[model samples]
Each structure stands twice: as C-alpha cells, then as structure tokens.
Target: MPLDAESDAIGTLLLERGALSAEQLVAAEDLAEGWNVSLVQVLLARRWITLQDLYEQIAIYHDLPLVDLEADPADDTLVRRYDPAVMNRFSTLPLHESDGTITVATSRPGPRTLLHIRDLYGPRSRIVVATHLQISAALQKAFRDRHSHDAVFALAEQDPDMSAQQVVTPPQILVLYVLLSVLLAGVAFAPVPTLIALNIFLTVFYTGNFLFKGLLVWIGGAAQETSSRAIAAGAALLREEDLPVYTVLVPMFREPEVLPILAQALRNLNYPLAKLDIKIVLEEGDHDTIEAAERLDLEGVFEIVRVPPSHPQTKPKACNFALRYAQGDFLVIYDAEDKPEPDQLRKVVAAFQQSSPDTACIQCRLNYYNARENWLTRMFTLDYSLWFDLMLPGLERMGVPIPLGGTSNHFRIDVLRDLNAWDPFNVTEDADLGIRLTQKGYRVGVIDSTTYEEANVSIPNWIRQRSRWIKGYMQTFLVHSRRPVHLWRSVGAAGVFGFVFFIGGTILSGLLNPVFWAIFGLWMIFGAAAIEPFFPLPVLYLSLVNLLAGNGLLIYLTMVAPFRRRWTDLAPWGVTVVGYWVLMTVAAYKALWQLISNPFYWEKTQHGLSKHTASELAEAKAGGPEALAAAPMPETGP
Candidate 1:
C-alpha cells in the first residue's frame, strides 16, 4: 500500500476497533494536516488508543508479530550490530537473528526507519511491532553499561563553577573580606569622613534601587492594562491532537501529606492524558513520600522516578537525573504543593509558538493558595504578588535576565539539555539557570498564567526557606561575577545592571535593613549629638530621605500588589511590610552564616501545614479544570 493509504488505513482500523469515534477521528485528521504531523502522532497524543494498542493494530494490519522487549529480551549479538544512538534516534531495536536474517522491533516502522534498518542489516531484515515503552527500555538497557553515571552529578567534576559546588571563588572572598576590613577600620579611626562617604554611597544606591523597582511597578501596571486586549484578540482554544507531548516533573522529598492532593491537581490538567508525561521524582531514601506515592497508585500518565541517594541531594539534581528519561518536546517543573492553573501548558505552548526560537523559557506567575492562613502567609503572599505580578513582567519587558521562580517554569527540552539543565550544587538552581540562559543569549518570558502554592506560614519554616533562597542568590552572584568582563559582554549593560539590582539588591536589602534600623533607633533614642561629627548636613539629609522614602515606597509597592489579584482585603495588611523586612533580616543573617559555612545545605520547608487544605481542595474540585482555563489572565503591566 502507498504511504498515505497506509496512514488512512490505520485511522480506519482504529475507528473500526472503536478506539476513536468518527468526530474524534476527523478532528485528529484535521490536526494532523494542520500541524504537519503524522496521523499516528495525532492519535497517540489524543489518547484514543494506548501505544501498545496502536502498535498491536498496526501489526495486525501488516500481518506482523507483536514483541514485548521486557518479556523477551533482545539478542545481545544482534543489538551490538547497531549503535545505541542510532537505535535510540530511530526508535528501533534488534529482536533476534536467525539464518543470517535479522528481525527488529520498532514502535514507528515508517519507511525512513525501515530503510535505515535494511541498509544496516541487508534486504532480509524484517520488522516486528513493539510499544514505545519497550523500545525505550531496550535502549536504556543497551546504554546502561556504558552510561551508568548521571550527567548532572558529573557536571561538578567537569565544570566546578557551573555546578553548585565551589560557587564562591577565592577572589570574591578576598575582595569581600578586604572591603569589610577597610570599612571597619574607617568606622573605627576616621568615623566622620567614613560615615559621610558611606551615607552618600548608600543614599545613591538606595535611590537607584527604589526608582528602578518603582518604574517596574509602573510598567507592570501598564502591561496589565493592555493584557486583556491581547487575550481577547489572540486567545483561541487549543486542539487536542495539535498539542505536543508535555512533561511535568514534580520533585518531592519528605513531604508525604500533600501527595494525594498533588496527584489530584495534576490529574485535573486539561491536556490529553496520553500527551502528558508526569514524573514524580523522589529521593531513594525518602520512604515516607515513596510510600505515599505508592498508596495513591496514580494512573499510567504518572510515573515514579526514584533518584539514587547522591551528594547535593537538591531538587534540581533530582530533576536533572529525571531529565534523561523525559519523553516530551517541552517540560515544566512543579513543586509537590503546587496547584498550577489547568490550561497553563496550553498557554505556554502558545507563548512558545508566538515567541522567537531564542525564547527558551516561559515563567508563569505564582501565588499562595492559603494567603489568609496567618500574618506570615499574608506577608509571603504580598511579597510574591509584588515579585511575580509586577517585578518579573517588568524585567521581561526590558529584556533583563529573570530569576526564575522555583516552580512552573516551562522550557524547551532540547534547549534545556543544551544548556546542561540545572546546577545540582546550587541551592538556587532555578535562579542560576535563569541567569545562565540570558548569558547564553536565550530569552525568558513571563506568561499570564498562574500557579498556586502553599506559603510558609510558620516563622521557623519561613526563615529556613527564605535563608536558602538568599544563600542561593548570593551563590548566583558570586558564580556569575567570577569573570566580570565576560558577564558584561554576554548580558550587556542593561542585563548587568538588572542582575546587580535584582540579585545584589535583594541580598543587600535583607542584610542592610537591620543595620539601618539599629542606627535609626539609636539616633532617635539617644539624640544625634553623640554622632554629630559623622553626619554632615548633606549626608544627614540623604540618610533621612532614604530612611523615610525608600522604605515607604517598598511598603506602598506591596500595598498595591494585592489589588492586581483582587485581594483588596489583604491590601490593608501591607502595613506589616516593616515586620516582614525584620524577618527577612533574620533570614539574611542566617543565610550569610550558612554561605560561609554550609553553602549547599537545602533547608527543607515543611508543607501541607496549612489548616485550609480541605477548603482549598474542595474549591479545586468545585472549580474543575475548566475554571482554571476560564479564569482571567492577570494583567502584566507594561
């Protein structure tokens, strides 16, 4: 039969077998033609039939035998005839050899693959049917002996700077120490001149940082104003067959309580089941989470990837290991507690299609589900709203490097691998990867979608989470700044400035807030007479202005952040921004200490602690998948 005839025959067979209805088959055919993809791919993507079933039907149609690689291992000598890479690329494996003739198992035994097989194995080579899973497993087994080591773990040995290990260079340490020593000496000896100079520098720095952030907030608001315009004009429903395979990696540790909820949330995604490759990555020794996952007995769409116990033991490391097994054109990471909007994947696909090829990443906005859990949750929500809702979009608009949020970051699989995936040793791999992507000349964009997560409601948990983040930021700054000229050339002036302010300012603000507060308190209580010599008129005025205006502007940004999300009631609680800064200061100090001591320690934040889980779950169930797709896209201000 002709190629087109065979393709049409397969569709006919599937319909005859009751695998697909007439309407679904027509829709699949239309999508296949529109997207320029194969009819088999469209059918598989739509989940009309399982891979096994599809291959089974194909075998019957062609009068071939069905072979299961798992049940029947391939002959070693026959497999050795072909290179593993060739076999993997073509999705074929040699099944057996008899009387100088070879039989091969292939999920896709198309003309091109068959030609290659015949070229290598001679005209006598015959074809057999096998599921994709079997072919993948056979390839893994074939390469297992030669490629047993995980790529992510080996990255540290290959490029120490790129890995999380040895992040802070010796020169950076020396530079920091010398600066601190000089500052202390000046404060002790030449207090008058030192205080005046220091105050002047800080005043300018604070003003720049404040104005930059305020501008972003303004731009973000404007972007939001026009967001609806774009949505209504360009938004269209995505066809199921047209959607590509999307891989979701959910990395979990000891948190077992949220497994059921996480599973349910993922299952509710609107994408076709067959096109969704969801991997729940867990540490090998995390028996609690492992057991919880097993108890859920998630459907075939979900797979459990147990990462071997290794150094760094970070979430990115786990993701990197799992990256090798992902079978998708695009991928996204979700935290265990994350409840992403259902249509987020479709939105990302649209964003990717609309964007340039250099745009390798799309970051979705994140908010807390239990925003009103407590004072800490409220503050966390406010901070998150300001960062994701306003700051990130502003950064994207300016083409500055973005620091990716830990979850809901979608990436092109090929680009992600070419960039060597994530830094296993870096505590903040996501942020580090984001910078690296920009430095490599790839663009990261922000989409209008959102993913809801549980906020760290407990003070202790908040500190642990915040400190780890701060430490990671510090690590990213040090790693990227090692070669200043290269970074400048790579990211350009705007990128360089954005990195300094976004990464450096975030770290310094937390560390410097307490010091300024202490100085202000002492001056207010004991009068300025004792320190009169240190504060000349200009320095005094600048310090007072920064103390009053800089902090107030930040508080105001937080206040307006909630209004974007229609959380008007919580907007009033932004007054607690001062207290939030105090808590951040504590975390900052802890982060500094950890950076000097145990830099790579991942302080796990306990989740599923909120008492509102039941309500959140009920809401999710009530809203269903369509609710998330139908929800308005948040205005990303210009």
Candidate 2:
C-alpha cells in the first residue's frame, strides 16, 4: 500500500513500523471486520499500540504533518466561528489562519474529514494529525462556558412548561391561592361543613392511594415473572459483535473511596470493553475523587469527564454536561456504589429491540446489596423490591408513566439529547425525565436487570436522601401539573390518575400521616366525641376504613414485596414498615419545607457506610468483576 494512497492500510503501516506483532495484527483484523469498524478503530479499541504510536503511523501513512494540540493549542477566535457540535463530532479543530488559509487539527484525518474541513472552513483549509483526547480537550477548553450554560438551562429555555426552574408558575400559584382562599372562607363561615368535607376528601384519597398501589403490585408481579425470562433468554443469545456502543456515566462528588468498586463493576459488564464508552463524570472542584480515578489507571475505554464548576451542582447537571461528549448509541447512568448485573446492557438492548419504536428509555430494577445490614436497609430493600421489581413493571403494563430511579436508567442518546436531556432544576431529574418522555409521545420500558446499591443504614442519612427524593417528586408534580388539561390529554385519564396518586399521593401521605396518627390518638384517648365534629357518620366510617384497611394493605404489600426475590426473611421485617413510614413522614415534612425554601438543593447521599464495604472493595480488587458478581449476599440473620 502506497503511503499517500486514498486506500492507505493502517494495519500494514503499523506492522511495517514495528508497532504491532504479527499475531496481534491478525486478531485485530478479525475484530475490525466483525465489529464493522476501521482497522484504526480496532487497534485503538484493543489498545494494541499507544495512541501516539498509532496516530504517528497514520500521520506517516496519510503523509500529513502531526501537531501537538496541547503544546500549541487551537485559536479560540478561529474555533468559535464554527459549530462546536460539528467540531466535536468530526474531531476537527481550527488551529490558526495564514494568508486566508485555515490550518485544522483533527484526530480523524481522512478524505471525508478533509471534505468536511474544506466545506466548513473553506477549500483553503489544511489538515494535521492529533490524538482524539487532544482535540476533545481543546474543544472542552474552548466551549466549556457554552456547554455548561446549555446543560443547566436547556430545558428551561426551550420548554419552560417542562422545567422545574420556576418551582411554582403563576397559574399554579393562582390555583393554590384560590384553593386556600376557598378553604379559609369555608372554615370561617361553615366550620363543621368544611371540616367534614376535608375529612371526606382526605379519607377517599388515602383509600384510593392504597388501592392503586395494591393493583400495581398485583400487575407488576405477574409482568416480572413472564418478561424477565424472555429478556434473559434474548440476552443469552445476543452476539458480542452485534452490540452497539454503550456510554456509561458514573457521576461522583466527594466520594473517592467507592471508585474502585464502581470501576470493577463496569469491567464486569458482559459487553465488549472496546465498544463501551465509559465516562467517570466528576466535578472540577472534586479533586479528591478526580485524583483517585486518575491513580486507578483505568483502561483506555474509561475517560474522566471534568465538569466545570457551576451552580446547582447536582448529579443531573453533571450528567447533562457529560452527555454532550457521549459517543454511544445508548447511554446509562450508574451511581458510585452501583453494581449492575453484567448482562444489564445486553438485556436493555434486547428489550429495546422487542419494544415499540416509541420506547425511548429502559429502567432496570434497583435493590440494595446490604439488605440485611440493618432494620433500615431491610425496609429499604423491601421498598425497592416493590417499587422496581413490581410497581414499575405494573406501570409499564398499564401504560402509566413510570418514575425512573436515580440510577440504572438507560436512554437512547438521540432521544435524550432531542428532549434537551435532563432538567438540572429537578433534584429527581430521573423521575421528571420519565414523565416528560411519556408526555412527549415516548414510552419508557422496564427491564428485569437489577443494579444493587449500598442501602442507607444510618437514620439521618436515609432521611436526607429520602427528603431529596420527595422534594424532587414535589417539583415534578408541580411542573407537570401546571397545565392540567394538557397533562390529561397527553397521558390520558389513567395516566393523570396515576400521576396524582403516585406522585401527589406520595407527597400528601407523608405530610398527612402524622396528622392522621394524631387524630386517631385523640379519638382513642379523649373518646369519639373529641373527633366527632370533624368526622360525621359517613366520614367517620371512611376514616376508619382508611386507617385500618389502608394501613393494613400497605403493610401487606411490603411483606409480599420481598417474596418475589425469595427474600423471605425480609417479609417479617415488613411488619415494622409503620416505623419506616414515620421516617418517611419526617423526610416528607423536610421535603415540603425545602420545596418552599430550597427547591433545587440536592442532599448528597453518603455511600461506603455499609458494614461490608471493606470486604466488597477487597473482593472487587482481588477477584475482579466476575468475583464481585458471584459474591454471595450477606447473612440475613440477626
């Protein structure tokens, strides 16, 4: 092959330059053909040669001069003239202009890139070779401000109605004022009637909420049984070469200790390592974790994405920033302590294949690895088991918009980007995105793959975490409920009902639980006459049903939640779920207050608190990904 020919052979060039062994060249050739990618891509993916060496040989082959982008950076003045997206996509940056001719630096230097450069920067444009990382770094340095601003305000600017930027819009505030004014007027004029009416409404709401939850569990349990089998079988038969490039985003802040565990888990994934575009998204200020990631010396597939310091430094904002550079057909978010099933990506791909074209996201189940660590962990596990393993699937079956868990949500990058990605203002951006996807004529699918996380064992930490979740739910409800007619039309009557009970009920129940408990306490201690004025005969009957049957149903649901997982020991602990509700009530009040005070604040959940953390880390480091996957559950006994 001629050095200057259009059909320059990269492998042959690498071999001639003594960059690759003969055996390695043959293997890379096979993978390159099977993966339907270029020989350069295969060589880079396999890490057969250092990037500099491979690019140098390519520079030699293409007869192009190689430039060090870092030593002599691109001119911001010239680079800003072209679209950053196009530049990033082509890995081409305008270096400088000389005599009306522009010099460009590109990681990909070829006829196609040559044409693109000439078309964009004019026919006088010239090309030079550089590494992919160098071009990416230059782009980031040049466009950080623009990308950061877009990440934070894209949804708010483009679709105000879908954003939680304004916690309560004018119409919503007016509705609240009208409702409060009506309640106050009724109380002043007709105290007895007002109290009775309020009692009836709340009693009915409680009854409906529990009943709705029961229906979901029943439906979800059935769906889980059938669908999980089909997904697993599909995943088993999937060929490694057919898998699409997947982007895994692990966003961390001040959590360096858990990086190793996360790294091992990603390596354990069954997907081809070369095709995985894993980005460890870290805040620019979080030098500790950033340094830790760098020291780990992860494989070439893993890249550290340094997010610029910005306000509302929440996970979603970090994720939004990282989403800009994602090079994958599909993207999934994992937390610092998450250990998803190795086949999760394959299962997600298979599920997408089996789903309708409108399916834009796949939500995998989330449970805790430290389920038996403490009372809180046990209850949290049962809660997740019900929410993920049961309720989400039921929501899918019934066509109700599902509330996505914080992690393990796999999205089609195109659809996600087109939707302006995540809302930075929503603390629970995942849940908000799920609802938004449904409203925008897209469907969210549920899969059986599970991502085990470190359950909160401490009470205060659990409350902070739960409070953030509830607050985000509050924000989601407010944002989506702004145009009630539009919501009803978009998601239909069933979706409307589900949203109200699922999101609204979650908020109201936590706030109202304490009041109901106090009311019941007074009725028992001070006699029925003490509460008789508030609870008329019919209203009293309804309140009694809500207090007895509603509570019982919730407890029963919690007990049965773990049965599907064959976590029978957790069933007995479910009886103490009332205690869990008390904690939720505390968190709910905190969430409510914060919604009024600090709606966008994200209460960071501290991981590495589990008693088994040290052991898990050691296992991950020593045994590798497979060992971590095959690790047995901790002893459930007291």
Candidate 3:
C-alpha cells in the first residue's frame, strides 16, 4: 500500500493483465519521469491501451468497483449542485448522498482525487470509478441550459459596451440620419458644390488610406523578420518540463471529413501530448462529426465538447461555451482544416515570455497549403501574407489595435475569461475582442509562426466567406464608434486614427469601388468632356492621382507580400489582383445587404474542396501519426 509500491504495482498489473507490452510499459515509465507526469497519463497519451481496459485494471489494483455511468446515470440534482468546471477539473460527480455521507463517482479515483472528493463533499465519502468521459457527460447534461445562456450573453450582461448584441445603437442611427439630411439639403440647394465637396472628401480619404497601408507594410515587414528570429530562438531553448499546460479549442460544425486532418495536425505539434487539453467543440445537432470524432479514437488529451443548440449559431458561441471547462494557463483556437507548423505553439509561448506583462493575446500568421491550386488561391495566399505576415506586426509595432484573424490566435486564459470571452453576436468575434483588449489596456502581439489552411478555391464559397468577414467588420465599426469620445479616451488618439484607416477603410472601399469604377469607365468611353462638369481641374487631378496611385500601391504590396516566403512564383499573379478587388466589391455589397437583413448569420465556408485535400489525407494516413510527430518542422523562410 506504499505510494511507490502502488505505482510500480499498477504497471505490473497492466503487464500481467496483458493490457500493454513490456517494452511499451518500460518506455512509458521513462517518459512519465521525463515529462513530470503519471505513468497512467503517459500510457493514455500514447494510446497503448483503451480507456476501458486501463480503468478496469486500475479498479482491480485499487480493489474498487468500476461503475458504468451509461448503464446507471448519476442523480441529476446531486450533480447540479456543484460547478461543472470544478467537477471536470477533478473528474468527480456526486452520485448519492445519505446519512451525512456522500457517494462520489470519478474516472480518476486516486489518493489525490479521493482527498479532493472528501473536501468537496464530506469527511466520510464513498468512491466509485467511472470514465472521465462519463463524468463529463453527466456534468454537461446537468448544466447545459445555464452554460448555453452564458455563452450567448455573457459579454452582453457583463460588458455591454464591448458586445455586438445591439447591432446599431441609438446614437449611431441618429448620426446616420443627420448626415443623410445634410447631404440631401446640400444637393437640393447647390448640386455642383455638393458634388465637388463629396469628391474632395473621398479623394483625401483615398490618399490617406493608401499612405497608411503602405506605411503598415514597410513597418510590418521589418518587424516580422526581427521578431520571428527572436521567438524561434527562444522556443528552441525551451525545455519540456518548463512548458505549461495548453488548451486548444477546435470548434467545428458538420465538417466530419476534415476531423482526422485536424487531429493529426494537433498530434504533430512539438509540445508534450500529456500537457495538452484539447477540445473538439461540436454543435449538439452535428451528429456526423460527433460520430466521426468518436470513431477516430483520439488520445486521452482530446475530448469532445458538445455545445447545446442556441440562436446565432457561430464559432464564437461554441468556443465561449467550451471555455468554461478549459483547464489550462493558455488557450488557442484552430479550425478544422488547419495544419499549423509543429513548433508554432512553442513560438507563441516564447513570444509571450518576451512580451510585456500586459500582453494578453498573440496572433500567428496564416497561409494556404494549396496556394498554387488556382488563381483565386494564389491571390488569397497573397492577401493573407500581407495581412498576417506584414500588417498585423505593423499594428503591434505602432500600438494600434489589431482585428484578429479567424484562427490560430493564442490567449491568456485568465484574461480571456475576465473579458467575458468572445461576443457570440459578432461574426468576426476575434477581431472585436482584439480591439476590446486594447481598450482595456491589454497588449496584443503578433509572431512569425504560420498555420496553413484551405483557401476557398470556388468563387461562390469565397464570396460567402468574404461577405461574412466584411459584415463583421461593419458590425465591429458600428459597435466601437457608438461613442467616439469613449473609444478615443480608452484607446488614445493614434489608436483611434489607426482604427479608422484600417477597419473603417476596409468597409468603405468595398462599398465605394464600383461607383468609382463606373465613373472611370464612363470617362474612358466618352472623353473627359462628358464628365467635365462633375470634376473641377484641381479635384479632377487629385481624383486621377487617387485612382492610379492607390491601385498601383495595392498591386505592388500584393506582389511583395509573398516574397517574404521566397514565393517568387506568386509575385506575377499579383498583377491580376484588380479582378480580385472586383470580387471583393461584390462581397462587400452582399455583406452590406446582410448587415441590414440578417446581421449575425455566419456564412459557412465549405472546406475540403481543394484538389490537394485528397492527397493530404492520403499522405497523413500513409505516414501514420508517429511518423508525422517525428517529422522535422517545416522551414518558414529561404
């Protein structure tokens, strides 16, 4: 009954029961010591034996009864009294209480857990064994409604100013009404003057937008190189025992086919598997993905969190629900089709260590693996290279609030929870959270790591995805700009200006491009004489400069974006970016319409459409999980 003897006996029992090979047990014991974890954890992480078999042996070793929760469910009222999060952390549930004594069920029924159960329930408590998954299911079933409500409205209740629950506030509507009235009055009284004034304002804005973006690229490019090298070096020196427990939330809905891809990618990470708290957050109604995930037989580090159905079914909502049960110092979000570089998490941890104490979030770069699939994929890759690889770092350097990309952003779990997690009503919850963090005096940093994803190869799919993004930007702008003075005081003057030129510019350019294109087309068809009255010589010259210079800068920036990765082949494709802009214009209009009609609808982008998907899956299956984990990290640069 001694501690060391019990530990040794557990291994002996597994070997005697034929649960694991002697060779495997020896390796697992060695790893448990090096990892500073339990031998059971090492064996579970390595998937050397089934959870049922492992628990059966443990029950035999401890001389305790192993009860199947599915056959005899826990008392709902008893389980409901305790916090689900606490229950999950301890993996214990109150099964029965009588005569001042409590009967507790747990998948992990060791001395420490027994002590915890006694502390939570009473001095005289009986222990019964159940799988961790069984206890988790009981807790979820007991607290589904409460957790669901909190996930959807926690930000709205806790921090109304940051939530998008109110799509357009009263003050915002008033400002729009006043601006429209003024424009109508001017046009009625002095058409030509009003027209000239409008032209001047838009031309100046166009010039400022162009200059600001060019500046961002210049600063961001330099920052990426320097910061990346430092983070990579620091990560290389990190020891396994020194690494903290990390929680990864992969929220997917009905994407069954790509589940294996994400599972393999997570396994391929360089971090210790035993230290990972992985949750595959799925909607309760998504039976296909749920069944598919179950069939995969993922390691003990992985768990499936079924989110109860709710209105405004978005990724943020699911993640918010999952956040409650997350048991880690740090947390990150990845999509179903993502394949992050193996050392990305290590680089993020290093970045956080090197950052200021106030740094609450770290964003990584995103690119597409199938960049050469087609013209659209190539353009999409360039866009991401500029935004994540270049623009985001520039924002970090200049103290501007960043709008986070959809995936691969890591956060401090405490800060994230203190901020009420993500707003379920905002389609672009990640971006909105970034700004909110800055307003609350927390810094957001960007690193050089990349998570390659499946780019939208089909034009319609691309439109659906882009429109939702644009609409989310619209919502973010509206929510933040409701009280301009409050925003300015909170984020400061420079942050306010950056917000305007970055977030505001994205929304306006999309809505305004077609009108300007029409004007240019008219002039091309019928000489300047046809449009002379609309443009005075001074205004006309400025308009010409805005058109030519702005477009040229965009094309040039796109061309140079891919050069950081030595993707010289993509440089030529950047010249065709004008067509890409036109598609954006279309998406922008669709986004505008949706903002008016259906604001919170998340347009799901169909994944696994790339020609490369089949080949990637084949390669993953052929190489096996062990092979993928042992493979060398991908080189990030020339």
Q: Which of the numbered candidates is closest to the native, going by highest lDDT? A: 3
Ranking by TM-score: 3, 2, 1
Instruction: Write candidate 1's Cα lDDT for 1-638 as tens digits.
Output: 12376668888898998887899888877766665566776665554566676787888877788887778899766686677656766778888888988888887776787788888777898889887656766665565433335544566665566665776679877998999999999999997788778877876787788888998888877665465345423435666657888899999998886766777677667666557788898887899888977765455557777776666778888898778778789999999888787777877887787778899999999998778878998899899999999999999888789999999999999999887788877888899999999988999988788898888879999999999999999989988888789899999998899898889999988988877788788899999985567777777787788888877898899999988878888888998899998899999999999998998788888887787665544554567434433443222211
**What lDDT does candidate 2 reach at residue 564?**
79
Worst 10 residues of 2 by lDDT: 1-10
Candidate 2 residue lDDT tens string, 1-638? 11224223777787888889899988877776666556776666665688788888888888899899879998987888889878877889999999999999888787789889889989987889998878877887888899999999998999999999999988888989999999999999998899889988999999999999999988888886667788888888888778899999999999998887787788778887778888899999889998988887666678888899888888999999989888899999999888787889999999998889999999998998889888999999999998998899989999998999999999999999999999999999999999999999999999888888889999999999999999999999999999889999999999999999999999999999999999999999999999998888888898888888889889999999888778897899989999999999999999999999988888999889887887887886797656867776554311
Between candidates 1 and 3, name the one with more favorable lDDT.
3
How many backbone clashes are present in model 3? Answer: 0
RMSD of 1: 4.7
Q: lDDT (CA) for every model shown?
A: 0.80, 0.88, 0.88
Q: Candidate 2's error at 72, in angstroms? A: 1.4
Q: For candidate 3, lDDT tens digit of each residue in 1-638?
A: 11255557889999988988999988878877777777776776878899898888778878888999889888888888887878988889998888977788987777898889888888898888888778887888888899999999999998897889899988788989999999999999988889888988988888888899999999988876767789999999998778899999999988998877788899888998888999999999999999999988999889999999989999999999999888789999999998888899999999999999999999988998888888999899999988988898889889999999999999999999899999999999999999999989999999888898888899999999999999999999998988789899988888999999999999999999998889999999999997788789988898898889888999999999998899988999999999999999999999999999999999999998987776666665788665545544332222
Candidate 2 CA-lDDT value: 0.88
Q: Give candidate 3's error at residue 583 in angstroms.
A: 0.4
TM-score of candidate 2 relative to the true fold: 0.94
Once fitted onto the true fold, the runs of candidate 1 whose alpha carbons sit more than 4 angstroms away are: 1-89, 93-105, 109-112, 119-130, 134-150, 153-163, 184-192, 224-228, 237-241, 255-260, 285-301, 614-638
Q: Quote the lDDT for 236 in model 2.
A: 89
Number of clashes in every candidate structure?
Answer: 11, 0, 0
lDDT of 2 at 565: 75
